[model samples]
Target: MKRQVIRSTTLVETLAGVDRQSRFQHRRAFTLMETLAALAILGMVVSSLSASLHLYWKYRSVSRSQITIAQLQRGIIEDLTSDLRMTLQDPVAVRAASMVAAARSESATEKAGSEQFLNVTEQVLELPTDLRNQPVHFIGTSQAMALLHEQRNPRFDQARSSYQSAGLSHIVWWVNSEGSIRLPLFHSGPQLITVAVNASKDRRGLVRKARKDSGGSASSTSDEDEWLVAADVTSLRLRYFDGENWRTEWNSFQQQALPLAVEVCVTIEGGPEQETPVVIWLPQASD
Candidate 1:
């Protein structure tokens, strides 16, 4: 052997050899820069996916809120229209008779007045809502026992004497403490009560009372405000075709209270607080 000697190399040459052996040897090996770039791209993709998911959920919530509001409004409108059109017919059910008594009793009025309106979109109680326009058969409702203890009407009295033994229930559609707006069912025979509905900022489908006007005078003013609208009123407007025009205020309506076509407006609040104002045209006096 002719003077075999070990090769001596600098640190840079050693490192270059290692790099060539590790990366340059393979066609698919990633460089440091390429690895960092891939990581950054992956992060961006993940962030974009997260943002998209959040947006999707937000839109879904808004859509659900709107749907709920629509349902609530539709239900109220159906019940109101049925009562107005078929108020003349009396309920044939024995329990419904008791319902009428409970609906109009002083205690009932007080109870309705005392009770606060529902605020949430969800329902409090699991009360069943009736889709059919059947006559109210009971007046005691879910809180029949509690309401009976309060005794607004003589539903118990009527049932006690009769062998038929039908009972009574309250007729109300509202929300409960659990953030739910319950569309309570009522089978009461006919329109036994008058309600002024409105749409308010709080509830979407309903507009609360804003102003009071009088048709008695050209100025449109009110004094006693007997024809008054209350707060939390989603909508309570009257359509009196003055034989010439549609009037909303009661005073003005009284002045010309006969409409060939009566329009009823209403709103229902459930979720997302939708204020849907519907103008239902009804057959009014031709003259």
Candidate 2:
């Protein structure tokens, strides 16, 4: 009986040892392929995380740019509204004289037998041009516009001219081909104030030029006079309302008048071609 119990105990101990050895061998048998697969999975997870983070920052930057552009658009609308409200009538002897000059330049010099014939022909060719009575003129095209109206200088404390008391300043909003919008204000003292809105030259983003103050130049020769009001503009379009409908083009010289309402549309980079336009209603001549 003692021999039988000792044999059973030794057998049980041998089986347990064998089981431990088998478990160790199984652990050692793990293939390099499995390890590589695990590493690949980890690498993929890390790459995905990095890409997500990159996209998040990129989107955040784009959002900030859009917000800035919206703010700029709002400010422009406000400024334009104020100017249109104070729009002045045509100043005398300006538009009509310009038309006459243009006509005279375009008119062909007729061959005549005598000086008397030439004089008569000149008088007949001279159409009675009405003197311009208002200080406002609007010339618009599909891609650009020139808006000339009157507005009080918001920078009264920094007025260039001391004699400027009333809001009788001639404001000109000119849009160029390179998506630069220039606002030039001329006062009674013939003082000129110019600023550039959304100026982007050669896709360099916002190019800020030093503000120029060269007295009364309608168009500043110096680039330093350009004040950057906004950036990344794509296009600027203006339309005029003639009581009944809207016209894409407005020539004050041809119409010999100002429109009842004006619509201004501005396009920024990465934005739609047509934006919600700022509509300005003008008071009649009687008003």
lDDT of 2 by residue, 196-225 (tens): 444335443322222332343444432222
- Per-residue alpha-carbon lDDT of model 1 for 1-287, expressed as tens digits? 22333233455678888998877746455566688899999999999999999999999998987776566557656644542332112223223334334444644556564233222112222223542233222121121100101121221123222222122222222222123222212222232222222222343222111112232121222321011112223433344344566554222111212123345444333333434345544333222
Report, for every candidate in turn, its global Cα lDDT versus the true structure: 0.34, 0.56
User: Which residue runs of candidate 1 sit more than 4 Å off their true CA positions?
Assistant: 4-30, 87-238, 250-258, 267-276, 284-287
lDDT, candidate 2, at 212: 30
**Alpha-carbon lDDT of model 2:** 0.56
Ten residues in sequence with the least summed lDDT for candidate 1: 141-150
How high is each candidate's TM-score?
A: 0.39, 0.54
